[model samples]
Target: MQAYRIDGVVRQGKTNQDFCIDLVAENEDQVREKVYSNFGSRHGAKRRYITINSITTIDPSESSAPVVVSHFRDK
Candidate 1:
């Protein structure tokens, strides 16, 4: 497993809100799917409403701080 940082925006009403999320996944595809599922469940957002700008692998050392982490399970 690898840590990934996904940067994107989600449509909320008439505006788009930026988001930075960190998760443990094997690849970028997994990261994208998790983001869609997570935001959809939490905010009632559809896949079309989410726009992923970038997905990058995160160094484990850089993730040692006290940041909120999200755990995703593959469906």
Candidate 2:
């Protein structure tokens, strides 16, 4: 698996809230599905409301310092 940085925006009410997520996945398609599944379930948002702006693989050297950590994880 590879680490990917997914950037996008989701429609929330009258606003479009931007989000960035870092996760481990195999490819861009998997990244997209994961993003949609995560946002949809966590925020009760529909797939149509989510817009993926960019999907890029993270270099291994930079994975040591991720920009956006998952808040859902236990410390």
Which candidate has the top score in lDDT?
Answer: 1
> What would the per-residue lDDT of candidate 1 be over residues 1-75, giving only the tens digit for each residue?
788888899999999999988777778888888899999999999999999999988775566423323232231
Q: Clashing pairs in model 2?
A: none
* Cand. 1 Cα-lDDT: 0.80
CA lDDT of every candidate: 0.80, 0.79
lDDT of 2 by residue, 6-31 (tens): 88999999999999888777788998
Error of 1 at 32 (Å): 0.8
| Model 1 residue 59 distance off true place after TM-score fit, in angstroms | 0.6
Q: What RMSD, rounded to one decimal, does every model reach?
A: 5.2, 5.0
Q: Which candidate is the best by TM-score?
A: 1
Model 2's alpha-carbon lDDT is 0.79
Per model, state how many residue pairs clash. 0, 0
lDDT of 2 at 14: 92
